[model samples]
Target chain A: MPTAKKSYSTGAFWFVAPAMIVLLVVGIIPLLFALWTSFQQFILPKVHFKGAFAGIWPIFDAPFVWLSNYRDLLFDESFRDALGRSFLFLIINLPIQVILGLIIALLLHRPGHEWLKNVTRIALVIPMATTFAVVGLIGRLLFNGDFGINNYFWNLFFGHKMEWLADPNLAFVSISIMDCWQWTPFCALVLFSSLTMVPIEIEEAAKLETDRWWHILRKVQLPFLLPGITAILILRTADILKMFDVVFIMTRGGPGAATELISIYIQRIGFRSFEQGMASAQAIVLLIITIILSRLYIRFIYREV
Target chain B: MIRLIRRLALSATCLALTAGIAGAWTLEEAAKPYKGTQISVIFLDRPGYRAIMKMLPDFEKRTGIKVNYEIVPYESTLEKEVRDFSSNGDLTVALVDLVWIGTFADSDYIVSIDDLKKQFPNIFDPNYELSDFFPLLLNAFGTWNGTVYGPPFDNYSGLLFYNKKMLKDAGFDKPPDTWDDLLKVFAPKLTQNGKFAYALQSRRGETQSCDSFMRFIWPWGGSLLDAKFKSNLLSQQSQEGLNFRQQLIKYMPPGIVDFDHIEAVNALAQGQVAMITEWSAFYSTLADPKSSKIVDDLGVAPEPKGPAGRKPALGGFSLAVAKQANDNQKAASWLFIQWATSKDTAKEYVENGGVSGRQSTYKDPELVKKYPFIEPMVESWQQGVPEFRPRFAEWPQLSEIVAEVGTNMMIGSTSIKQGSEEIGKRVEDVLSKAGYYDGKKKLAQ
Candidate 1:
């Protein structure tokens, strides 16, 4: 019995070794390097070393300005504005994605619509299949005040065209609409898979107790789908925090920094301004926020039946 | 025996003559040692890059050096080049924008022309004639802190491109001669029924900073910085310019604050707007029948003067060798730059939809007649402001602040005075952080 237990442990070590090494190389190493960079003044252009080690040794030699970058970022109005904008984006997008996704999942899970279910599932994947940057370009064209299709429809309803991309509030709404359009499908798919696990006998019992759809959903289905909802919330929270390519391609945080998210702000600091230390510090802060939010989700929302 | 000796002597003399002619350092000969070296650069989708692509085959055929390029948009070019340089990536040639010269030069990301020449003495063609380029373009686009880093490749001077039919319909025979004339005379008459008189490319980013915001202040004799590199934005002259821009906004399209160069130019091309001040490189687009609605009615003229005088915007890119490139790649890249910007190739480049910086290219009567924008472009270039946008390493950070506040000012979220003050304070803070005030770094030239 002792020999059998030892053999099982040895077999598990071999199975985990490759994944652990990969995580160490690609993930852990870069995160550690970024953490080290946050504590140093490592502006790329300022590094004066030359030759083969030019890219390396100077980075190590960069002046250690402990907490200076973090202090500066705390006082930076642009960074604060970006952080607030990202949170606002999350607040606006999270509820719509969650509720709408669950509704679509429930419809797909309804009995006696097998053919319809396949077609609807296939159609839903189209939005999720489109690349983020291409989605941004499409959004740009769709929101253009001069000749976009949205303006055409809007003019038919109203007497004049609307400045969708020009107005700050409208532009923010447009970005949200685009995000929901692209990501809601993914949320729907995840929730639908979770719904497939709902036991028929329990749903039948809940339906016998109350014929009302809301009552049955609240009592039986929702409790079963809490895990999926929690997952969606945590994933979307992290995604919205780091969202960049679409916003960059669409408005470029324009019309007076109306849509500048934290990622865009950090990109401007690190790549445009070459202030690597500040960017790294901002990244570390964002990482901590993400970790805390995910913990909150798992702790509070993932209830065991 | 005598006849054979005479024939052999004649053949020897002929061979010697051919070798002597080939010894004059042609680009093809200079590229001999680095025949198979592959160099890479970032290019834009603009006319200038297209023109170069059209001429690239000839270059590759003459010299065995293969040139690879990635087409990047203007907004991404700076970041792409900077990232490539920092990482010592595959880019062997740097396509530098005018504002990036100081940044690139200060960071030592690019090798200076003098250093390249010193390193590769035999690579330059005798007929290159560097002085043939316009003095203004040479200094403004290629030089930083009196150091010649690159040679001007894609050069431009802002010119007013107006629709002649629109002007005539409004009872004017010609474009406006001054900013006041444009605002008071042409704007009121031409702007009506959803059509605007003019459109400024004010979309946030460098377009807003260089094309829209600085375009206003320069002609009013307001500089971004004083003699001591301090903020000059809150001065009376600068405020006047900023206010004038605000007043001019009413004469533009409803959402003019979001119009980029493509949209603004399209407005003119599609007859939505009567006039737009744009770079000379866009002439081909406006001239092409497929892209323009008023090609036959298009008229080109110098940008209208302000209270001070004509101070057209100067913007373009230069070709420099990357510091990360090996010696062979550097030599081959230098040869390509020299050949691409040589005096002999200027006419061909211009004919292929490029705006050449060579003074002689504009002087050609044939080219002037073919490309109507040439005369006005030359006029602007001759009198343009070299520092239309401040040429300094800190300008990128400063430009961001200006773009945001400038856009806010246009949209009425901030008054001209408030916006200028905000920009002034931000600019000072950035400059201070860079140690300019403490004399640790050199002041902008």
Candidate 2:
């Protein structure tokens, strides 16, 4: 109660200093640098590593071209398109990922299907374990318009082969499908772990209150899984926001920028267009948007669905 | 100013130390001043780089200058190279794709070795037969704005690779000689039995712009930009090429919208496709018995001509000195560059199956006899399209526009007219922002 007398022990401070310093160097410095760079007109060198960092700090040498890059983005259709695409991608992907995860967790929680559960659980982890880049390649192959097994089956069943990555909406759908396939297991595994720990007595009590499964889930089971859901939400949200490699591999922001997302747009600006100033400005904007969305994401994950 | 003076003095010392040491100063003696000095060279992990890496020990032993070479995947090589260039590291020299010349030159990221040739005749070697290099290739791949930046490493001229057995089965004695012949006549015949006539690189990347799109343009009597540096994509000639490509898609492998060099070449290697217009450097992939089923039956020729002329797809790399490189490192880099690009080493380079840019290497009877693609590849390099890609600072954006629209067109997501219009408008936007329309600057040559 006496405020623990500000226990400034060298042991504790040293114990935590390395982690704190690492966080400062790796996390904060880059954020500050990005913020500073976002305000300036700096071209990452063509030979990107040669001379951009020659000075004490690149920000000191960068031109103070404030607000211009942001201003340009106001009228830039591509940036807007990317933002809209990213939002849509999240909207489509999040629900499917979450619902599928929950469903898998429930199925896996069944007591009698240990072999099926273990096999399926192993299968779920396998996709999550694979690199996203490899997944993108697999996605590309699976949806290949020419010889893709998906299209081959679609031709057989639907009497038509869909243009998966070439068509804009289809490309988005394909990426979303891959996203669901790759990430649902993550959400499911987390939720399933939480489900296992939900105390058997509580489920027994809920069952007495009501034999209805939905009633038990809504009243008893979901509350226990909220923390897991929220954790999954945070991780998935962060991962989805900056998602680059999979989309890059699957679509490269193309089929006429149909699947282009904010990350792709930023990359195009910084690397392809060599407009680092604009890209940084756009990134700062994206960062702000991401931070704002993080709160909503937390709230949404924590709330009753 | 003081730094410049010191560099000049150091260069003088380098020259004096390495100079006048009688005839044929051994690589060891020449590198005495730079002994133990480590120089870093970065390039993509291709067959050519493997050849150089294999010979690296010999260089190290002779010069006493340890060589550190890093090979990255081709897709990320540009980003990595640029990342290296932006950092003031020990990266002495970088191998640049031809498309990067404008960006590198505009940034002054590389030292213009052309200017240094006269200043350090000893280092450059006046007896060196500069003209022995294919002039078209020299200008296209290694030179920028009338100044040489690097020596050619891989001379990639697009060649028509055909499944000889497939063509023979299809009752064709030879590969098509022209675009009309290939598309109208041969493609349909060969496309029978589940074999495609060609697998063009229609993927939305550099190959899409530089390989497939540009390959068709010149031969169709088209170019990327007009005299005023406007988008020529909407030009009649350009449309002809685009239409030709749209038509060719039917005969090409399905899902061509996703095919890059690897897929296109693989389709040929797997014998799923009858033919492909792939880079000469990929010759090894097609010839590898392990990867290719038709290795023995592979036929090669220059890209088929169009109404205007034979405009070969020009894509390759050159080894250029980084501007941030120290004097001794530069000297050693020049030495390694020369040795790797020299006629004698080139013979070995070709014999080992790395496509050497030197005309001599291509004309070597033994090499030609060994590699059937050499003669046609040489011809293709001779008539290569330097402006097939605009080679401008704005090229990346413009090329993206073209690739996006072109791929959409190929995939039936966008009409030829719509694709052409979109490409023209987007390119105009990029150029206009760069003030190309207002005459603030000329489009990069």
Candidate 3:
């Protein structure tokens, strides 16, 4: 018996060892290096962390100057307007993605719907496979103020062309529409996979009793799908905060800093400006904000097991 | 049977040993061949790259150094260079942009070519007349204190490009000489059919901070930093310059704040703008029938004088030896750089679309007859003032002041007065934080 137990331990160790090695090399080491770098005035190749010990000075000093960076962001009416715009985008886009996904999933789960299910699933997931740059470029052409399809339609319908990406009010909405168009299918796929796990007997019992489809969905199916919906929201929110390649490729935080997000602002400081230390400080702040928001989402939405 | 098998195996082993020896000998011969060692040269995919490609086979035959070149896009080139530099490997050579010279110098990523002067005197021949190369082009960027950090590779001075057909139709036979003439004559001719009169990059990041603002600011007698490391972007001259730019915005494309270098280029090419302030490299683009509608009709002129006369900002690329490279690599790189920029080589390159820095190349009779803009461009480069990119460690932080405040002014979020003041305050904060504005240095009023 003791020999068998020893063999089992050895087997487990062999199975886990490769993964652990990979994690250490790719993730753990880099995380530690970045954390160490955040506190020092280190440039590439020449001044690595080994040469210097700047302690927590960057952390202390960063806040004093970064207060101004933050003040510029918070006090600028543009930022506040963008924040309000983001909220509007979330309110309009998020629920629709989840609900549409749920409906598609439910419809596809019907008995003997195999071909339809596979086709729908594949079609919905297509946008997820595209590169963000390609997506943004395509969006730009379709949303360009003068020659865009949207403006063409507006002119056809209302006798006047609308500058979709040029106007401050319309830019955020235009970006959100593109975002929703691209990501709604992803949400749908997640909920659909989760919906497949719903027990046939419980759903069958509910359907047998209730003549109304809406009643069955609200009372039985929605409660079952709550966890999937919460998971999608949390994942999407995390991504939305770091949303860069699309906005960067499309407008570059412009039409007068109208679409400038915190990520874009931090990047400009780091890469374009070359303030490696200040950029790190701003990055650390952004990381904190992201963590707090993620926590809030998890607490409010994923309360129960 | 056992004896026979052993004998066969021994024979096989002997054959394998002989093959290995032959392979190693061949490799040694290849490495030390008179045909010269093959070295990798990486450059950004600019017109100069094409020029180098045309001239490399001749260089290989003449110098016996086989050139292996990779021309990547600008973004990818920067990434690859930084990666190669950080990895501390032997890179033969790189065609680096002037803007990156400071960062490269600070990091000691590239080596100095001073020793090559003694080793290869003919190659570094004093009579090749490096002095005649526009001093701004020669030393405009990439130096740290007094050390010459890089050799100018592909060069262009910023020039004002106008559609000749459009300007002629507007009843102007010549390019605008003064700022007032530009606004009064060219602006109206340039503006028609809801299209802009002029297109200049105003997009709120590096372009706004560097090319566009510098174009206006210097000519209007404005400066970035005063003697005390205090920001003087709020000076009256700077405000006037920025205000004039704001007024220019009215005659520009509607989404002026979003325009970058490429967008401005495209607008002019597409006949959306009559005049554009752009790099001389755009001459190649303008001359390309496939790219520009106004190919034959494009007129090149020196950037106009304002309160200050014809202080065109110099924009160009340079070659630097990687500091981490071994001695052999350094020597080989210097040989390649010298050969590539030589008068004969440069003239051949200029004949093929390249805008070379050598005054001799521009004056080449064949080149002069073929490319009329070459002489005007040379004149422009002579008059051009290479922006003294502050070599201080805090340049990156200082640059942000230009981008942020400059961007704000473009969007009309701040008047030039307020924007320049904001720039001053922000720059002071940046300087103070960086320890440059410590008590010993008297603050600029």
Candidate 4:
């Protein structure tokens, strides 16, 4: 308001421009190109058109199909089925991960207990550090119908075996377990750091005033842990919503679309089918849906934070 | 009398297994022009491919072409090939799946070696004979619409591999010849005490289509597409085949729906399963000292015949010279292709654990003795279904739809009638959208 500064050529602007340019090239450009490609019948090496506006710039050079692909996506049963399975995976996985994480954090949040504090913390992080491919392979081996450790132990304990990847429901539960197992540590570590920041003196005061553990937990610990819980909820929701690798490797979204996540379905459409136009439309729609859903989640969780 | 003759034949086989081929390849004089040339290829990480790598030192020495090869897993290898082909990447020689032949030929992504023979005379080895390859194998893997696109490499026809000792213990001295004999005779006796009689690769991907579902369809008189290019999945023939598969599913492992080629093979190799109707290319894996426990007791036979005929599942790879490659690179690649697939090198290739498309390799006295799978594999290759999974550009999408429906049936979630109808409708819709099947012309031919 004081004065309109002409700082376009300033050193600060120049230094930041490189980062902006890189972001524009890597992220924004592909996104915009994807949007453009969404409206075109652009199956490479065979079907294409030099777009109306692309001749001059080369960016707009695909035959526009005008939302037909989007219309097709709306009625696509497999896409809807994938979206449903993705939500189911999240519904079953996120809560267990968060709750388990919170329990682990609370147990490890001791001030003087170095063994509980350090070793358990290191052990919890190992799963998160492992790649999903390895995690999926490990999950498959463990859950194998014959000679699998899960089956072996399960038979001894329960007197029956579960077809982990054969039946649809079991496959869904198996993949969710794998996903939850890998991500629980991420939630736990993130919450544990936040738990550590809660003043011990305040906890001591609450504990002295209220002799009951539940009363102290309800009156003091919960309020203190709210921010951490909300953070875990928001992050875990975002991550579990787009889970791909474990589901892809373990079952390949199979045994009849049991574990077909949104990302896996997109891979099927884009890479396997090579229906670029249809895939792009599906992707754009999925991105919008995920954004809205995540925002709503964040809004609900962050209401009183 | 048949037993006595068989014993004598077995003795001859034992004697035949002792010797090795001496003059396998003669390349130096012809390959002088391409000396020190470098070319790259991407191959599936199969036992046959590992064998190729082992023989590379000899190949490099003989041809003087520095071969730079990368081995990728089968699942991701398809995606990589498509990505490379679509992007027009600088690939000198590319490994192509059989199903991609039509697309590659149509898109001109790969050179038509037969067509190019006219353009570049004297490219192949002077005595390089195309007739050496089994006609069906060469046609199914390399040729598209009568135009040869690539030369066959690591060809496979689905063959039955069984545990001989297990079958004998069950009181059957021989493998089943018909689908009826398999279920009625062998499977019941063998499937007992935490063991499975057979395993079918009903996984919801390429294996289901290329190896399992499609293999059974035609043998029972079913066809994926009729002469009109319309899906004939719901035809009476298809129902018979699918219903038979449903009945046979009983003797298989509980998680057969989750089994792919690798899992099925592993099950057989571990002796958890007694038999596998698997690809001939996996013969090495089953016989490998490290991988297989039943190496000494494996028996090979052509896939059991159905009502129509014995049409084993045909699937293989081809070494296509990338048209995107430069002239020198293309010429150098041609030399490698010739050397790798030549009739002279076929026996050596088989000796090194590589599957050869050459009929001579399968017919070789020593190679046949060393690998029992060779004889029946050759028989299966001759009748290998050309359109087992449909060789076309739109085939990837078509096959996916087929796999999905087939898997649904495997899980018992969908009836054969429902699954077949879904396949027919979906395939027709895809074909229609692709401008195939105009009302009058049919596009079937």
Candidate 5:
């Protein structure tokens, strides 16, 4: 019995080794390198090295400035604006996505809607499956002030065209709309799957207790949905905090830095400005914020579930 | 029989000598050792690259070198090249923008042409007359400090592309010859009933900095920096230029702040706007019947002069050998660059929708007739500012700041004074941090 158990354990360890190695190589190593880079004054253009291994030596040669890169971020107005914009994007987009997703999930959960639910389930995957960059391009076309379909309809309905991408406020809203379009379906599918796990007997008992649908949902379905909602909050918060491709592709943080999110700002600092240390510092700060937010979600929301 | 044999040998020797003289230095000979070597470069989807692609087959057939390239948009090209260089990736040929010369050279990401020639002397063609390239283009686009890093390939000069029919309809027989004329006379008459008089490609990137914002400042005798590299944006001439641009905004399309080169070109091509100050290379697109609605009515002219005489926007790219490439690959890349930019291939390059930097190419009567934009482009090039956008390692950072403030000025979100002052302050900060003021680096660079 002991020999058999040891053999099983060995097999399991071998089975998981490849993924663990890959995670270490692709994920953990880069994270550590970035963290190390954050501590130095690593201007890319100033670093001079040659030969095949030159790419690896720049980090070693970079002057250590301790926490000055992070300290500079405190006084940087553009960084502040980017952070504020990212938060505003989250504030505007999260609630719309959550509420719309819940409503869709509830409707699909209704007894007589199996065929509709089946079709919607398939259709909902399309937006979630679409590439983030492609979604941004689609958003650009959709919100184009001159010849976009959105403007055509806006002119038809509002009797005037709206400069969706030109106006800073409208550009933010346009980005939010694109984000919700891409991600609300994800929230819906998750919540819908959670709804399936709700015991039929418990639902029936709640219905008998109160003829009102809202009462039954509040008392019975809400508890069951809490776990899925918690998962959504944690995941979506992280995703939104790091949202870059769509905003970058669509606006490029245009119309005077209206849509420049934290990620986009980091890219500008690191790649465009060649200030890798400052960008690394900003990235670490963002990571810390993401961690704190995730902890809050898991502690408060998950505790209830 | 002996006399006849002697005559035959003499004739054979003469034939051999003629063949040797004719094939003295060819791309085929230079690329002989590097045949079958696959080199990679990043190309844009612009007319010049399309021309290169059209001519690529002949190059491959003659040289036996396989050229692989990734076609990316202009905005992404810098980042892609930087990432590749930083990682020592497989990019053999570096397609460098004019502004990137300082940065790429400072970082040692690309080898200088002289160094490449020294390293592989056998591969260089003696007949590749580097002097044939316009001196202005060679200095601005190809050289950094004192070293020639690459040869100018895709060259441009800002020219006013307008719809002749629209100008005629608005009671203007000719394109505006000055900024004052454009704003006061042509603009007021042309702008009406949802049609704008002009469109400036001002999307918040290098376009805003180089083409839109700097386009105004340069012509008005306003420079981005002084001889000491201090910000000159708060100067009287600069303020006048900014104010003029603001005034002209009334005649420009709504959402003009969001227009990129493509959008601005499309506006004129589709007759939505009367005129656009665009790069000379875009004439091909404007002339193509499939893309342009006003192909028959298209007219080209040098950009209108301001307080300063014709100081048009100068922009272009050069092809260089990547430092990361091995010797053989570097040789192949250099050979390819030489062949592409050579005076021998200049006419073919121009005929295939490319704007060649070779002065001799433009002087060809056949080429000038075939491409109507050539005369205006040549005029602009002759009178254009060399430092249109400051070429230095710190330019990318400074350009971002200018782009933001410039766009804000265009949209009326910020006053011209406030925007210009803000830009000056930020430019000082970037320059200070780069050690320019402290004399750690030379001020001239």
Candidate 6:
């Protein structure tokens, strides 16, 4: 029994040893170093390296600072307005992705629906595979303020022109539309895959109880897909939190910081200003907020199931 | 067989390593004049680099000293230069922007030319004909605290670029001479088919902070720093300057505030704008047959006057030897700098369309005839002052505040007075953190 215990400990050590080393070197050491540095103010190219043992004191020292960076962000009213606009995007995109995915999954899973289903699945998944950067750039070109194809169509439709990214309200909507076009198919595929995992027995029982399609979906299919929907929301919120590359390369938080997000603000402080210490503090705050929101999500929604 | 294959691979690896080390040794031997020496030069990878590359063969041939050059984009080079100086490394021979000389000089990044003259006269070269250089080019970016820091390269003082054809069509024979004249004569001509009258780079970044904002600031008789490196952006003159830029946007293309250097240049090249206040280097691109729509019909002049007369923003590069460099590499680097900025060399460069800061280059009758923009540039340079690119270690932070607030002002999102005051407050805060200011007074004393 002693020999077996020894062997089991050795086996576990070997399995976790690489990851432990990586975590120590890449994660813990840097986190500790950043934590030590964030308390002291920074000027580019020089810091006295006078690191005192400042625990969570820096956070408490300026309770208003969180509001300051946020206030600096609020100076641009366009971005403030975009928060509401983003809701419009979420409203349109969420349902479209879910419905399209569910319908496709239903048709494809119907036993005999093979060729048509496979073709549709391949076609739908292709957009998901395309790089988001390329998609956003193409979107910019297609919806260019002056010469884009969309502008031409818009002129034909309304007998007038629209500066897609120039207008504050439209700029947010443009990015949202691009995000939806690129990511809706991805959500659909994930939801569709989850739909297949739904037990056939449950669906058959529900159908017999109600001949109505809507009733079957409301009772059987959607309830089965609840976990998938939650996963998508969690995944998307996390992804959106760090949305930098596309927005950076495209708008550059421009037309007067209209599309500037938290990530953009963080990048400006960290890289452009060379205030790494403050950037680390900002990052820590953003992380805490993300964690709290995630916890709330799990508490309110996931625990109910 | 597996053992034999492993042995073969090992032998090959050893051979490659030996070859690599041998190549490195040869390179080191060639740099014997600067052995045990490392010099770091931070510069922009643009026209400034082109001149450096052109003269590298000559430099290596003469000095036998290897040059360690790091070329970054123009926007980030200032921060990188500061980092190179602040770090423990012997960062010798940095190519800094003209505006940055003050910032670098204040922090003791590079040895002052005054110090060099006293201690290292061989490097100073009083006979180097510093007087021959354009006084504006020499004084505007190079001089700090009454001492020169580095020689100028590829001068890019702002010039008024106009469409001669457009001006003629607008019933104007000459380009506008002042801000008021620009609005009165050119704005109407420039606005056609839903296009702006003038194109200016107002996008947030270095361009907004250094070029566009400074262009307005200087002409409006405003400055960024006071005598003691304090913020002066909230001055009455500065407020007026900020407002002038915002008002100009009214007559500009839709989204003028969003236009970066490339976009502004493109607008002028495509004949979308009648005039553009831009760098002199832009003339080369505008005249290029492949890029410009109206090549022959283009004209250049001194930047239009504002309240203070023609005060075009200065933009160029300066070569400063790193303080941490060893005596030998410093000497070798100084030798290269001397040769590069020599009257003969600068004139040769000017003849090749490389704008030289040396006044002697402008006096070269053939050179002036060949490049007509040179003389007017010299005149503009003579009218030039350093503005606020004086010795101030906190200039970089001040630049960011200016770019951010100036951009807001241009878009009409914020009032000029409000934006200027905000910039002043932010700058004062930064300077106070640096111990350069104390809100109501300078802290240096």
Best by lDDT: 5
Better of 1 and 6 by TM-score: 1
Q: Tell me model 4's lDDT, rounded to 2 decimals.
A: 0.80
Every model's Cα RMSD, please?
3.8, 6.0, 11.3, 9.6, 3.6, 11.8
Q: Give the TM-score of candidate 5.
A: 0.95
lDDT of each: 0.88, 0.80, 0.69, 0.80, 0.89, 0.68
- Top-DockQ structure, candidate number: 5
What tens-digit string does per-residue lDDT give for candidate 4 at B403-441? 777888888899989989888998898888877866632
The alpha-carbon deviation from the true structure for residue B133 of candidate 3, after best TM-score superposition, in angstroms, is 1.8
Query: For candidate 6, what is the DockQ-based docking class?
Result: incorrect
Worst 10 residues of 3 chain B by lDDT: B25-34
Docking class of 1: medium
lDDT of 1 by residue, B19-105 (tens): 776566677778899999999989999988899999999999999999998999887888888767876789999998889888888
Work out the TM-score per prediction.
0.95, 0.92, 0.83, 0.91, 0.95, 0.80
> Where does model 4 sit among the CAPRI classes?
acceptable
* lDDT per residue (tens digit) for residues A1-305 in model 2: 87767767799999999999899878887777777877777766532332335343442356687788788889988789888888888888888899989988988886796778888878888989999899999998999887789999999999978878767788888988888889999999998998987789988888898878888888788888888888887777767878898999998877767778889878878887767778888888888887777788676667653
Q: How do the residues B1-445 of candidate 5 rate in per-residue lDDT, one tens digit apiece? A: 9999999999999999987856697777778899998999999998899999999999999999999999998877888888788767899999989899998988889999888877998888877888888888999998988899999999999999999999999788999999999999999999999999999989888989888889999899999998888999989998899899889998988888888888999999989999999999899889999999999999999999998888999999999999999988998898889888988888999888888898888888888898899999888877777788988988899999999889888878899999999999999999998889999889754
True-structure RMSD for candidate 4 = 9.6
Q: Return the DockQ of model 4.
A: 0.42
Which digits, one per residue and each the tens of the lDDT, describe model 4 over residues A215-301?
Answer: 866766676666777777667766766677888888887887777789888888887777778888988987787678767766765
Weakest ten-residue segment in model 5 chain B by summed lDDT: B21-30
Q: For candidate 3, what is the DockQ?
A: 0.22
